[model samples]
Target: MATGLILIFDKTHFSKYFVVPSTLGALLALAIPDLEGGAHDDIIYNGLNPNAVNNSKKYGINWGYDSHLFWEFLITHFLSLVLPFFLQIIQPKEEKITIKVLWKSIYLTFSVALFLFFFSWIIYAIVEKHGSPAQQISWNANWFYMGHKGISTLGELTKWPYNIISLTIIFFVLFWLVFVIKIYFEIYSFNLSYQNRKIRFFYIKRLKKTVFKENVIKSKH
Candidate 1:
């Protein structure tokens, strides 16, 4: 096996692409209530008729027993963001991986996760207590609003500027997740190619040495 050399991390590049976008993505994911939100009682009681007694929008992720700060934020959400980091930071460069980056990455992940959750909770609490949405914090009024009127018309749910901003953020996060997955696969392929080249080079060197020894022996004979 080839030994890897210590190298400096590209902190600027990492922060710009990896950390910042991930942080923003995570924040948006956590803060924004899921689209599949509905009141607890709003269920399809009958196949033909639906009971809208709860006035449930009938969508959004069920923020059930696992919605506590510890469960949702650090344990669930924080660890989830760290999964891609493990795959992406595969040290494929061999020489370009450093302890500083490793430690800094862990630190940044923890800090950013905490920060996002804190903001999410703060916004959630304020919105809950306020009874009505003061401004368009979430992109879709139909998506995650707790109290007051749910989306009456399609226009209410999908407006102009807010919709653009919200959809952009959502798409960004989706692309970012896909990107992380792609990076992992690309690194895996690169590592395999690198190992094959190294093996070929080693074999060629050994073959040259053997040929040189053979020639020397024949000359002596």
Candidate 2:
């Protein structure tokens, strides 16, 4: 998803117009979920290990609520905000948006999302079967960990709402794929039209010059 936006906006002439909006759109997609209440409550309410040896280790601090919120902010929004800009500026500008580029982006996003989903499910299963420390670990790790696994577990145990959200994200990706295809076709058509126009104009100019030279030769003869 991040790569796709970068390629679409960064590699194209449209970058001047689309880059900021595409970046903001990606950030908005990631951030909106965190604003609402969900599984993060456990970490937010309880806090991190203060007295533990790990907490006392160098660079260790009991993050508690702040830590939880920080992680939530990072995963849910910050990473998304950072990634598009990073890709936009860092990647080689010469990269072209071929079909390979488009499909690769789609595949990468789906693969990452699916892996996160299943990884969360496994964590939830462990927490459900074993309990507590594991659950705590799962909750505290990162927003992606919680959002993917915790919400999935919640949906399974409760009813249908959680599942619906998961499914909706998947479908949204599908919709994005359609949009990507449309953009590719539009770019392709525009390029082809421009090339054809240039070629025709070149031929027309050459033909006019040839005819003018022929008339000059005839007049001299």
Candidate 3:
């Protein structure tokens, strides 16, 4: 089984595309609000002649109890904390993915995440306390405003625990964004180097083609 797995990894482009994208995509999906409940409610209540209150109730999905949201929270936070270091490991040694670099990336990611989360709370508090639509609009224009609104609304409607979880989600998203920026720069550097050296470009092109061909072979096998 290990041999088969090794062959599969060696013979597929999974690492090139699936690894990074799937990891990042899962993280992003986890970060976003569970529109799944909304979707399910829409499907279930696909009828006419409902009253306003009933319609509202029908439209609402009990996100508070949804297992998926809990999973998303766990997955997102785990990925945000661990994926940067994981990425560093996967990168070529020549790429200089050092402990220092990994630490810096983690620090930046966590810092940004914390800043956005707290900032969101501050905005939420101000908007809710002020009780002015105009003020809310102004606050919404700010960068961390979404966190504020989400946290405030959830807190007002639900209990403290839920509100705290919501804030944690915001932090996860912020950290994920930082990781994305780091990956972008890494990819950009590779592309720049490839552009400058014909030999490098040749190797990259060959690598991609070989990987694709290997994937096809593996799929057939």
Scored against the true structure, residue 92 in model 1 reaches a CA lDDT of: 30
Better of 1 and 3 by lDDT: 3
Worst 10 residues of 2 by lDDT: 199-208
List TM-scores for all candidates, in order. Answer: 0.29, 0.42, 0.32
> Candidate 1 vs candidate 3: which has greater TM-score?
3
Ten residues in a row with the worst lDDT in model 1?
Answer: 1-10
| Clashes per candidate (backbone, < 3 Å) | 5, 0, 0
Q: Give the lDDT of residue 132 in candidate 3.
A: 61
For model 3, the superposed segments whose C-alpha errors exceed 4 Å read 1-32, 36-55, 58-96, 132-221
- Candidates in order have lDDT scores of 0.39, 0.44, 0.44
Question: Which structure among the candidates has the greatest TM-score?
Answer: 2
- Over 1-221, each residue of candidate 1 has an lDDT whose tens digit, in order, gives 00111113333234312433454445554664343433232233222133433424444334455556325544444543553354346643431223344345445544553454445455556666663432323412332212222322334543332443344445446544654554344333432235644643222123444444432343343
Which residue pairs in candidate 2 collide?
Answer: none
Candidate 2 per-residue lDDT over residues 42-124, each given as its tens digit: 33345645344352332313433466754764564555456545554554343333334444544554565456666666665
Ranking of predictions according to TM-score = 2, 3, 1
